[model samples]
Target: MAKTLLIGANSTIAQALQENSDREFICLARSEGNLNLDGDLSELDDVTDINGLVYFPGTINLKPFTMLKEDDFLNDFKVNVLGAAKVVKKVINQLKESEGASVVFISSVAANIGLPFHASIGASKSALEGMARSLAAEYTNAKVCFNVVAPSLTDTSLSTNLLKTDRLVEASKERNPMKEIGDPQKVAKTIDFLLDAHKNWMTGQVIHVDGGMNNLK
Candidate 1:
């Protein structure tokens, strides 16, 4: 019986995971779920015996660097980076208890490649990738595997606006080798694979789930 815990369980990716996952699962969300935001994660006495942990809470804020304010950076950092950290810290013991536990973090291609109007979100995700690597190194002895999946322009509620216009969609499609925007379900499947036993041989790597948006011209 594998016990997996998911944060941001309401998001499309998380919801997809819930629909596809065959293992026993626990979900933490801001509302209407097993756990709420007010639920302090630093104390995880209740959330014990977990084998896999997935942090799904993320943002897809796209705005020019000049338009960004101090608060913009702070808010993005809080949600994308700090929020995940809080939950990870709380579940560290349980994760280590699992010993050969797998931890998955959601990152974006914006973290590495330069994108117009993606300064804030990109910076935060870059930090997230770094954090994953650091933790993977720190908990090596505990056999806790930490890895990140960085997708580009995934078709989710987070990027609904950009995907709505035909012109925008065409332009985005033309830019990728796949010639289409990435499906959230596809990305979720990749994440699911990463969290499985097959991933035991891998860690501290950022696997790209983009539709060639990052690599291809």
Candidate 2:
């Protein structure tokens, strides 16, 4: 059986993926599980195996550049970039052992497009995209594929304040050609497709899961 490690198991996207995927899941979350990239995944010492990995730590504090502090950028990069790197570094051996493994990082469309007050988050996510591409190139010989998913506005508790008001919702919809907020399930399904063994042919790609928000209309 293929074992998949999920870094942010508590996330809505992670939950959706777990429910939709047939692969064996090794869930990891901050404080809730033994796997903490910030610390160590000692439990894996006993398992010695896994097929794929998905890192889904993210933040959605959209604020003006001036108001954003240095810590904001640091925190974003820590969770969005360094956090993923730590987990990947720890389990890289297992990934290599899988002989054909896939790693997915959750990014944001803000990485590609310029959005007001999205400086910190965008910069961090952009780094994640770049990092994934580099890993894909470096680990191709190891039979490990690395990629990123950049989603626009999705309905999650993290962004509930922004998606609450009718005005905010309509404005968000009008910005996208699809005229709708992205569904968490749809995004999860896309992640599922990218992580599938069949997708071994594809790597180093930054897929946009936005509802035509980054481009079109």
Candidate 3:
């Protein structure tokens, strides 16, 4: 049985991954969970041989680039980029222990496609994508693969603000070429695949789980 670790366990996407996964998952988060990476990760000391790591911690800071202050970009980078880097660094040794370990970072379609008021998030996620690709290159021989999953607007707690009203939801649907918002389960399934041992050959890739928003639009 491969051991998997999930950060931001309380997140809807993480919960979806847990519900759909058969492998035992050690969940960690701030305050309400097993561990908080914001402070210390000593909780991971006892855990070993981590075969997979999925980082679900992220933020959505939507504001026009002109209105965004320096702190806005910094805050988004802290959550989306720095946090994932820290978690991955902490578990890297354990990942190296597995025959074929995998790391999946949750990103956004905004990283690849331009959208108004998405500057902070897009910049941070783009950094994350670059970091993941570099790490994948460095760890390829060690069998520790890194990849990203970029999803469009999904009906999750994190996205409640975007889908608060029927009009907002309908507008989002119309914008997507698929005419639908992505489901958490659909994105979770893709993450599950990236973490599978059989997916050793598939690394350093960005999988767009959007509703045809990244390309079709």
Clashing pairs in 3: none
RMSD of each: 1.8, 1.6, 1.3
* TM of each candidate vs. truth: 0.93, 0.94, 0.96
TM-score top scorer: 3
After TM-score superposition, the amount by which residue 116's alpha carbon in candidate 1 deviates from its true location, in angstroms, is 0.3
Model 3 ranges off by over 4 Å: 31-33, 197-200
Cα-based lDDT for every prediction = 0.83, 0.86, 0.88
Give the worst 10-residue stretch by lDDT in candidate 1. Answer: 35-44
Model 3, 1-217: lDDT tens digits are 8789988888899889999989888878874757665666777777786799999989988998899999999989988999888888788988998878999999999999899999999999999999999999999999999989999999898889999999999999999999998899999999999997336588899999997788884
Give the C-alpha lDDT of model 1. 0.83
Ranking by TM-score: 3, 2, 1
Ten contiguous residues with the weakest lDDT in model 2: 39-48
Q: Candidate 2 — which residues are off by over 4 angstroms?
A: 31-37, 40-47, 197-199
TM-score of 2: 0.94
lDDT leader: 3
